[model samples]
Target: MDESLSHNDEAHASSSHSGSRRGGWITFPFITGALVGLTLAAGGWLSNLIVFLIEEFHVKSIDAAQIANVVNGSSSFFPIIGAIVADSLFGSFSVISISSCISLLGIIVLALTAMLNSLRPQPCVVGSELCQPTSTLQDAVLYTGIALASIGLGGTRYTLATMGANQFDKPKNQASFFNWYFFTLYSTTAVALTVIVYIEDNAGWRWGFGLCVLTNIIGLAVFLSGTRFYNIDKPQGSPFVGLARVAVAAFQKRKLQLSSESKDYYDGHDGVKEGIVTGTLSNSFRFLNRAAQKIEGDIRSDGSIAKPWRLSTMQQVEDFKTIIRILPLWSTTIFLSTPLGVQSSMIVLQALSMDRHIGPHFKMPSGSVIVIVLLSTAISLTLIDRFLCPVWQKLTGRSPTPLQRIGLGHVLNVLSMALSALVESKRLKLAKANHLQPVVPMLALWLFPQLVLAGIGEAFHFPGQVALYYQEFPVSLRSTSTAMISLVIGIAFYLSTGVINLVQRVTGWLPNDINNGKLDNVYWMLVVVGVLNFGYYLVCAKLYKYRNVKGADVNSGSADSEK
Candidate 1:
């Protein structure tokens, strides 16, 4: 009787533990999502401000792009590192807390700079010069503050998003949740991109950045305070080491086989059961672990390698190679980002060159108009996600497909760029002919194309596709994989600047000069790139297949938000 009672007690305890473990995963999506929304809002605000500042401050667009790109790169670049840290050691909560604080400090600097700028006022100059020829020392301070904040923002980009998605554990439910989760991110942007920008531009750029800083502070506080609400996963160990191991296994497959002489993988009368390595989970997991060991052993043994197949996991994670497998499909994202990024650079320049004085009584800040458009996007996103997504699912018997949303957005990106280019081209001709700024900033009205089309595209594309990428990455590599996709956008910004500089070098064209700012040509360049990206996606559509990792393993039901 005593033995039977003990067995019953043990069974009950096991059941309770199993129940707790199962329930824990549901929180993953919410946690990662909150962080993603916060970071994306900051991204939109920064992208908007950077453009206006360059024009208003009379700096070159290429220079401004480079500065903003620096922060953009960081915000994107750090995700792989954060993913590795999160997957292996720190866990999601610690990673988010640390990264959010880093970003928060950067925002504080910007807020201070904004507060300082409020002291100097010169509205009279607003209507006269197309751009500020010189900024007070305080202006430089503002730029630096914004840049630092962008860096902080970039670092947390991937980590929090990944962490949030990890909470939902059911494959089917996880699938539905992912769609909803992405919707939240884009919807929030529609709000931030529009409302935040409008307030900042109408009030003051400093005030705009200052508000962002305050918002970030609130985000940080909310995140930290809600720490207890999070589903803290068990820390696996150094995710970098794990990734390295997988790379090693992949690279050293032949070597390992030769050394084992096919003996390591036992071929028994009952069939085959491969020898598993330590610190590895499943078959693929072990293969990776074993590969890492073999690679390390080879490195130690040979002392030299020709063509050196050793992959730098860091760069591999961010550069073309790691993501190249998916690039053909993801090419669409590149097209979408160009117009999205332009909301800051060329767009703002066009606004500056136009007649910004509206109706004698109102001098519209070009950047402010762009902000309103973005805020409108946020509202639209909310309506669509909350209402449209559900209603569409009921009517169509399917939700918004990632590919459809992505393709639609790409189309919109092109339209926005094309419209803006035309408006800008006309404004330039008018200004040049009159020997004065155009009667009205046509660019203001042209912003509608970007505001409306771009907003709609983002509502569908940004969140939908990003959620897909996160879902597709392997458990250990989830964060790193997501970072890989995001880095492309960041890299593209840097690349755009380089490309512009290269064009300037080859043709001896100065950027932002009235003659060179004949951006109709550059807009054409974007059009060509956008079309090519669209073509790339078509190719991917044929070869790519969606993987819902959650369906495969209860451990990561929230892993891939696949169709």
Candidate 2:
């Protein structure tokens, strides 16, 4: 018997050793490079979509802006479903691989549309009655490409972030990976905005979209090449199923008397105590504790639960409670992001109406101006990681908490909107003085400060939100946790469209021609919304207590102190 057990142990140990050797930092470069290529491809097409629709498809500028917002929303929204699919069915590697293929196909179709003259409407001459509308076939082809590309990009983006973090064991290592991940994402996106948008403007849409297709294929190829080195986690049953089971079990056991003894509740398969309460049930969400209450026939002779709906493991119960606790804080971020979405889409219009000339030789594409936000985010992330964080730790003897970082983001976001309002007010004054010409005397560079501030706010809050969710979420739901930020951004973009439509219907704040409208009022309204949202966030953060205070302390040194 001893010899048999020793042989089994040796085999298990050898398998683990092989897996460790095959994965880890050795695969980092390949994954990062794949991400760079993917970002370049996605950004190349998406950044100039509004311009393409207006110039080639003969869509009105405001209509094109709405389409772009919807596309952005869909791209963000589908990731939640993708994360669920990754965690529940396919796993990250399979999902990413499949999504990449789909993206490549979509980009190819999009490139064809750009290259084939019959696939689009006649080129619209600006300020001419000779412009042609798109055919039914052209519309069908364009929408198909948009849908496929959105779905594909959605599936792979945040899922890759989760997969990359899975390669690291330490929380610090995971945090560092997120910083670099966003840095790479923003940097590559900046390149696409400048280079690809320039190509689309100067060389034609065919060459630009062709570049997107080439990069997407390269990204897919690089990802597949690293397959042997990836630490692929197999999909367990859906975590959502486990959470639902907890709720059902609690409801079923509602009439049963509560037990004070620790042993009366199911601990887990190993019979080891694990949760915020350690041995006893946590007092916060007392009703959920009933899910783990041991009753007659709840346990079988083999030590498993006889009735799954009558009893659950303590870990399962706690996981559900953690999600419930974080929801209020999560909600505040939605309002925080809504204004940003509105600002980004509106800025393109603002740039179109303003002087975009940098020199006598060149005029900037409106899409390229948004790269200011990406560049600012990338540079700010580097400075924060290398300099600000270390200096903060030295002076304060602790790193900043996620809540603090998010709070600072809120303040900065409000300031960005306020600055935008002032800038627009000045632009409107200039437009009125210049007799509402197609281009105002004010330079597009005047729009940079607000975008830069918004970018800096993203640098602080985006990674902070990801880290907070990853650290706090249940192990089974970690992938979904990372995708939650994407979900918020998605919903916010949609809501921004609703807000704009409502404003357009009720007031003249957002006419098709922004120069004839009160654009400053819209920015001022966002400032008000941001300030109110920040207050709500403060209340939520203050009332909240960390479930994993020890882990939080190790990560930030100030999480417990804040409580």
Candidate 3:
């Protein structure tokens, strides 16, 4: 196989997929990437599983955020580094391999800390009357464990996904490949969430955390197993450099060119899912990065012009300007984010209180609801997307685009949140009526609509936006572009927490007490979140620009790389 032919052969390949399965050695990358992704999720789940324990040990929410930030940041950090090393020294495959190892070590250490915690004398929970709280010691150990886990998880998350994307070429197969890529990502998450959460819920915290270690080992094994047939990327400088250079030029208001790569460079765009029209400047985020001088650069041959691409339309420039201007509106989705987020927080509280009954003799485990996560998501997507969507297409004469899917999800999100709030409201009324506990058996069932809605919502929302990002952003900013899109969810997570707290404070829902008092107000609050999320969706719908930029379509045949 002529090495140069790597370009010509793949140049024609679609960004979406390739039929070439690595029958021999190539399986290494595939298995490695998937394992990394699953392991990362498993590790993050462990952190969630034991977060209350940390709080029990008196670990403050600030400390918990530090630990979580480490894990979450990995999703962004590694790819930027990997993209650099990949374009410069080690390829994406190598970066992924290295990241997996790093993350594995982190999980191992975290597991060890858990073992130590089980043996240590834990501190008492704050505000205790008679009972001693063990949260202090638990908090110390969790802090250490989560710290290491975060670095590892963050590095792994970024490397694996970027590497996975590197596996496929673009243009012809771009769409289909993304569909499968997205399918696997969510499916893998669904599977991990279901099985792992149960262990955390039932098997004890130590084993639950240890499971991430198992996943890491599995991922390493899979990467090793597949050695041949992987599509390798040509090494370049840090993607950050390209982004930086492009950004500076965009603002100085100049024409854009590769300026870095010669014949050796190939343009790759990850946002193949965004359905923006060709020749349109609809990538608002990328444009902002340019103006900010962070993610600016040209996807063309080496040049000295030192200016950003002077896109023809000021309207397009304004489109980006418009989107950035409207970011605060999208930011409002954080409120809806708050309700959905209680899954690990208040929802878990509810889950614990539920009648853990499953079989005739066996009690349902606390974490068992996670099993429902995947099961419900798969069923709904297949039923709604595959069956219902096609029927709708026949009726409306159009297939559901990513945007349409988003709209549907927003609608579902409203309903899901409302259902949760209603259940909480009922729990309050039932408490008042019967002088009973605030946590109801029916609340567990009520969560069904919410969780199922979330899964369905993600299936459409994240993947759709990811597809859009790749299709629209300049090739240089592709990986970073996707990361930013992903960052929104994280931002939403933080914002949601704040909003929930604020509402609870204003309504006096905190310190939920002995009977059915404190939590009922909490339920009504979530109801409001659902309504607001629907409105945010509407706002985004009105302002978003739709553009589809193909790799080949945007390709400027210029040569600059000397190496």
Q: What is the C-alpha RMSD of each candidate to the true structure, in Å?
A: 8.4, 4.6, 8.8
Q: Model 1, range 388-454, lDDT digits (tens) per residue? A: 7678779997666656666777787777667766766776677667665435334355555656766
- Candidates 1 and 3, the one with greater lDDT: 1
Clashes of each: 18, 0, 63
Kindly list the per-residue Cα lDDT of model 3 for residues 173-277, writing each as its tens digit.
333334454456555665565566556656765687678788777777676556445555657655455434434446564432323222222112321223432
TM-score of each model, in listed order: 0.68, 0.91, 0.71
Flag regions of model 3 displaced more than 4 Å: 1-25, 28-37, 40-91, 117-119, 123-140, 170-184, 225-229, 234-303, 306-338, 430-443, 475-481, 512-520, 526-533, 536-540, 543-545, 549-563
Comparing 2 with 3 on TM-score, the higher-scoring candidate is 2
TM-score sort, best first: 2, 3, 1
Tens digits of per-residue lDDT, candidate 2, 1-563, equal: 23423443444467644433244565678788889888899999999998888778878777788888889999999888888888889998999999988888888889989999899988667678578878899999998998898888998888888788776665555666766776687778889999999998889999999999999989988988887667677787678888899999999989888888888889875655332333556877898999999988989888988988778888888888999999999999999999998998899999999989999989999889999998887778768767887898899987777788889989999999999999999999999999998799999999999999999998888767866776688876765766788889999989988888888899988877889999999999999999999999999999988765666635442211111
lDDT assessment of candidate 1:
0.55
Q: After superposition, how far is residue 347 of candidate 3 from its true place, in Å?
A: 1.1
**Would you list the clashing residue pairs of candidate 2?**
none
